[model samples]
Target: MSSIIPGTQNALTAWQPFNGARLSVTSKTSGVSSSLPNSLQVQIPKVVSGPIGFENTGYWGIKVQSGWTYQGSFYAKSTSFSESVVVSLKSTRGTVFASKAVMGISTSWTKFTFEFQPSASADTDENVFNVAVDGKAAAGQTIFFSMFSLFPPTFRGRENGMRIDLAEALAATQPSIWRFGISVATRWKWNETIGRLEDRPGRPNTDGLGLLEYLNWVEDLGAEPILGVWDGISTANYSDLSTWTVVPEADLQPYVDDVLNELEFIVGDAKTTEGGKLRASLGRTEPYALKYIEIGNEDQFQPESYAAYRWNAFVTAIGAKYPDFEFIATTLPSTALTPAYQRIDFHMYNSPSWFTANAFMFDDYPRNGTKWFIGEYAVTSTNDTNTLGDIPSGRLPYPTLQGSAAEAAFMTGMERNSDVVFASAYAPSFQHIRNYQWTPDIMTYDASRVVKSTSYYVQQLFSTNRGTHVLDTTPVSSNDTAPLFWVASYNNETDVVFLKVSNTGSQDLVANIFLGFTATDFATATAISTPALSPISGLFNVSNTLEEPELIIPVATSFALPFSDRFNYTFPATSVTVIALQSTTALEV
Candidate 1:
């Protein structure tokens, strides 16, 4: 696995008519045109001529850290005599950190370079880069600007890279598998996301998060990619039962070929396939960490018989081609006595109460059938009045502590039933603050900062402290029904016991934990807790001004060995706690 901290690289691109550039011409008569290829043309008809400025033109914002050097360059040409243009980096307050003047401009395209180091650090997204032409012009005088490039040190120091802060935040999650495909899977064509970044057509994804970039991110995070292939089914048509049908085999064959070719591009070697050669040409000689492929996003909408037909066709073709990889069916098999695929996908989105009550949902699932993948699950409670004002009044509630605690309880169930549940991932993993369509996402961010939801911390805690084997533990009292849930596991390699418990009630409860061994068998014990706040509805909601609090901090006096054979701990009301016991002996029972 790679280090959690990423290296450095350049974070800005698309300089010519910069991706999101805004033109500000002081003179109304002066016009700016981006119709030319790889360039922006500014025309001054001599009727009115003055400085023309462009700001906020990058893909997002130019993120600058304190005491870091940023290199900038641009190409410019003028039809008139020598001209001068000033370029500078400034904060939202109009404070120029650094500036430079390109003294001479010729008729021919010329390149100019400048370097600047911000004296102070900008931890926010209020920074921007600007290029301005400040002078009176004669008739027929025009200037052309192209290939404007500015680069700050990135997370790996690679050219055309990702933001360091956001990358680090994602890596910290320690995810086992990175599943890509939300609504994008319906119309996502793999060919459109490859090749040059500038050449890719503008679509709903304006942040430049293409296939290659996503694969690189997955590789950097030490996680395998689970690519979702489009099934040539539209979301609109899937909503109507009358239109529920599968595309003919002849029509679906070409799409299946596209998916297979994509897989070849991902896993094939340089000499084996054309897609592999293309992958090598893109600077990645080795195949990616690709193992699992999903047939479609959610095929549950189709009629069961038709859906089964689609699944069999996809499984037969893709499975025959890439037998080494595992395939996941969107739903259970409809025709086969045994499952046709390796795993079945299930999704759940409900209230907090539902998750807590269903903590043991998979306890009785047959151990012999197809494994299950909880591809999407979350506790979505619609009661947060804090951020409700920001959206429409009827919008759903934000993620709250009650929801997170319930999710914690649900995750403990998953850990206990890991044998049946092979893999799972929370849905809507990322949301850009400005362009988000989903509510209660795990990670929300602007250009400069990332806000981890309370649920995010819950996932981090469980992922980092996962165990190898589940240990049997006594069930909670049948008389007391205050929404208490628990799961116990032991790691033979580490010789440690992980006790995860969640209490979603009003009153504190004392839990008598039986280790089935003597207290002296363990050397030490540490506990961490996420406490629910008062009137629980007022739980902290992640937003712009403030992120989530330190809800997952360690608790010093939560657990104690009151007797030699038993451990006593007081679980706070409406809270989730994990107690890790370091043992000298690896107790099997």
Candidate 2:
């Protein structure tokens, strides 16, 4: 288990391959084994005068703290009898803190253990763990190595684990739910991700983010998982985009079976079903955390007739077995609503101006149909001048303060109408910087560091400070050109009122907040503001920026007239402000 809170490190794990590990070899030739699976074979043609170092490429964001010991080990075998290998943890500058020598290496696998405690506190994201050959080796002498595991006390101290710093950063956000397997929806098959890690086929662009790992991440975060099952649709032609369609019934039935079994594996316990039994073998005896099972990913590309047929078939089959589970349709069904289809997904990727203007997009939406799930949404504005057209081109835009403020404005609308919008999540939630395709990601990170975008802070603010119910608030006066967006929600349990306000204009404006209820006295008021007009550092790009002024910083400038029932505050230009008011008087039951 990780020491960090669960669900926080959703993007920590990656495929552990020799190349991916970024091993640096010197005076020794090393390559992955072809005959022996998961083994790295090293051969020294001639012994060098100095120690031949085989250092890891140092991409694993390992943080070495003073007085903290890290226990690690690896399996090694040498062709020559009684040959020894020296293992040590070293800083990027080649300063060794700890070392261990293993003797009596034979043909069979032998585990070698070592412990390292940094002499001084250092966060060496590019540091390497090295295994150096001390002495000369005969011509063509071979050494086999496998399962090179190193764990620096993880978040919850899970055996094979996550980086603590990254985990801590994510847990701070307090995400309520996680939606997984959406980007790879067309290619992802649930069965391919279960069982042993090595046995599963690798996902394209994703560094081995299997189903079990995803579930464990969600479980760690204490958040629910929304699984996006693959819709049994295949594309026949690449040039002709219209060639994609649902597979034949014979093939579709097997795909449906796979999805059903996946559900069983998730929600079933011991003695429940075959998938459940397999789940038990994987160490989870009880059902894992799963609530919403999305039928497909953006299924609107396929013919409407076939898409409807596929949706009906999947819903009918899954609903029959797990009647309690709620199913989310990828697109609005062409036909009438079915009991199985509890929600419909809505995706939006528009400009910053468009998002701010359409803050109340869902206000007029009919409540007679399926509920709304903002499954994927982000403001797709680019910093590059060439990419300013209707579509994206050139370098993508970093998550700017302007974009985040616009999103915050839109989110206030969503919260005000939370009854209609059941759940929402930002798209491209996790992106490995080296292998990312989309831009303006919520969180971006390289092998060594994780950088939360401005959009992430906005999401975090809303998720952490959510209220029990919406409260109607009327603004005394507002300019139509320089619109001031605000939403108020009350937490009855805590006797606190949360007012989120966004100002998207050049000049500041004063607004009087009217709750329109019984008389109440304000106890204390604090506001968190993200002002877009504030000058930011030039180096503050999407991948290397922190939240300015922090997400929930204090605001000491609010006035309540001595004998009045109103509170007044100045809204800064191009800013997102969240105000929390604690009332002195109690509410009437």
Candidate 3:
């Protein structure tokens, strides 16, 4: 929680005037620079009934917890006499949760910092980070403020770290990898997001999601990092973001050099490499366990420049140095090169029906070749019925039973082809309920509460129960899969058999699974199904929203794996289920 002030085009539009305080934005000097030019200027009115200043309802709300220290700092300059200023965290109704006062602030430009510990937590997130002054004492005076920030206790107590509650929720998922920056708007600017927060030019200290912080995040989650580097190409006619700028081949070396420097900082020896030394100076003596460096994101939009040399230029340059790092290409690898690519990343965002119908899409691929990573996949539409085939209509707002079930079926297909499909992740993982452009995100949150979607539970069930090898079954196959799809896997490490099933149609199916290997003593079944909480029609299409986050959550019960080779399970009309049974022996593949 760095500065409550948002960098919205570096404007003062985020502040709300309070108690007759006239507020205006200015392009000023001293504490300001050209990068972030606009600063908040407050003009105090004549003596009034209460204090006069500005308030920021951060990201729609500010969450305050009891006995938690809120650290804040800001720069200010006064046109006339030195005046006292009051900074506080409180509800909009004027109930102060925490308060601090700076006595007789200097008239010349100076920095002020404060630490506030609230005795009581706020009832709701309808609060504000506020600043004010005595209207009577500072009557008719003008003041300028810049570079403001406030933060609660950080995740893992890392200075300027991630939000704790969000981090904890992600940890529970047992994530295997975290994709850092995938789009052009958020191209991984390695140079701008590292070292001391203060030294990072243009960005405020609250801008702490730097490269180091990202690596620390990967470390904390016990996951590998997929670093996405910019390859000088933007989405066609996307926006005014770049005027569709594509860096010339002559100028591509600097970008290639930037990628090498980034890798050096991450995995190079602290004593031998310049980038590594810089990292060591920042107190990261040990190298981060990073290996995958993805070149660009979906660069195929402009195939001419990308395939011609852009991809190979980076691959050739970096591969010569760090040959061990596996490269994942967002675009199709050049066929001319030997061993086309180590891994390829592909994305898909379509309808739920499309996902279920195409569940076996990967099964047709040749088994022995370049591995694949489905970096992004999601069910975004009601159907492909829109007038424009591209503009999907009646999109899902949250993960519905039908959508999640469809995703599960697709997962089962991937698990069946696990050797070729190395990994897959849902696209647009998180969203804030207050404002969002994308729908059906895996996790949704607000200022204070987090809501896991039905899709989230599906992901957790599969990820937590992923086994060592796909197990072979006997008798009737579970792949009568138009309505029901399944895949059985054996975890050699734990001696457990994980059977995942997904029923995607209106009618339920009774699966009688007969394994060649003997079953273990007991078993448990976990499922995300149509909600029984209330009688809602069209159960399959039912979804979970912020108002009812737990409406369609996974339910678990003590079930049993048959003493012999067969155990029966009745798959619900629209649901995804996982059964884990202890098994000492597995059938041969």
- The 10-residue segment with the lowest total lDDT in model 2: 18-27
Q: TM-score per candidate, in order?
A: 0.81, 0.82, 0.91
The lDDT for every candidate, in the order shown, is 0.65, 0.64, 0.77
Each prediction's RMSD to truth: 7.2, 6.6, 3.3
Please list the residue runs of candidate 3 whose C-alpha ends up more than 4 Å from where it truly belongs after superposition.
1-10, 32-38, 46-49, 79-81, 107-109, 186-188, 198-208, 236-243, 333-339, 386-393, 474-480, 532-534, 584-589
Measured with C-alpha atoms, the lDDT of residue 266 in candidate 3 is 89
Instruction: Give the 10-residue window scoring lowest on summed lDDT in candidate 1.
Output: 1-10
The best candidate by lDDT is 3
Q: Which of 1 and 2 is the better model by TM-score?
A: 2
Model 2 segments beyond 4 Å from truth? 1-38, 60-62, 67-73, 109-115, 137-139, 183-186, 189-209, 234-246, 303-308, 336-340, 382-391, 394-397, 432-435, 475-482, 518-564, 585-589
Q: Compared to the true structure, candidate 1 yields what TM-score?
A: 0.81
Whose TM-score is higher: candidate 2's or candidate 3's?
3
Instruction: Give lDDT tens digits, candidate 3, residues 18-122.
Output: 888877666644444423444677888766756889999887898999978878988788868476789999998989988998864565557788998997999
In model 1, where do residues sit more than 4 Å from their true spots?
1-41, 44-50, 57-62, 69-85, 100-116, 122-124, 137-151, 181-186, 237-248, 303-309, 336-339, 382-397, 476-482, 519-560
